[model samples]
Target: MNVFLGFLYVLKIILSSVASIFLMIAIYLLKKLDVFHINLRMLIMHALLCIFVNNIIQMLRFAISLSQNIKCSSHNQFPAPFCAFLCINGVFICMERLYATFNFSKYENENFSYFLAKIYAVLWMILTLCSLLKFWEGILPGRYNNSLNCELQMIRENPLKTQWHLILTLLFFW
Candidate 1:
């Protein structure tokens, strides 16, 4: 059992590493092509970049857990904000598409400035950070009260709350 589990873990690490490498290559190619100069493409690239970074973080956390014989659950909190931002980015992408759809004439003729996209990305990051802090407060009261180890269980303990949270999050993202 232990050997099988270790094999599965190693397999996961290999797959994650391969995916990250592919993302890096894709990002490099996109950069070389200057795709980021376009507003929508810039936002798409940001999402890819975030995924790549999140993957790297997960891999590093896994490696650390293996090396130190520590459980990976303790590292869960670190990626929450990344996940939140990715969700928010998806919302921004949709909003951009909707705007383009509504203003097809101007959107097609005008070379939209990347400045606005950059500003939106930065603003979303700030808002996500603030909302995530509040979200944690709601999900796990006394988050800083030496209860870090059990924080994740709070979500699992309340199925209805979790479901509602997911529904609300999806609605907000949409």
Candidate 2:
């Protein structure tokens, strides 16, 4: 058990390190270009943020196991980092979808800068509500599988728990 846990810890460290590297590159690239020029930046940031969240989640997971005094009893946990990642990522994905549907005409027009900013604000609010539903109200599935040493559970196991993830990964990429 000790060896297995140690191995998992090492794996988590490796994954997080790789993610941090990618995140650094992504941020650097974003600095060099505008948001429109590097749309992939949003996706990369979402992935890195999720990875960082997962690292924190894993630490808390171990700590919860080690400390019997902790009162939280959800066997399937959703740490704050993952929760925040899910919320942020979900909102971004939704906003992206909305843009696709509407063709983002207002955003493309120079005169629509103020309206576009408000659209972003609305997106933030929608994501906040969705995240509250996912995390606090249990609108989405809560049980996350641990078969693989990875961030986010398998879609098969958790279903639409990461609905936005699936849409972006499958539909957008295709």
Cα-lDDT of candidate 2 = 0.49
- lDDT (tens digit, per residue) of candidate 1 on 27-87: 7787678644366776777767777876775666455545544433333433445556667
lDDT of 2 by residue, 64-103 (tens): 4334332222433344434444555556556666765587
| Most TM-score-accurate candidate | 1
lDDT for each candidate structure: 0.61, 0.49
Worst 10 residues of 2 by lDDT: 68-77
TM-score of each: 0.64, 0.42
User: Stretches of candidate 2 above 4 Å error?
Assistant: 34-117, 125-168
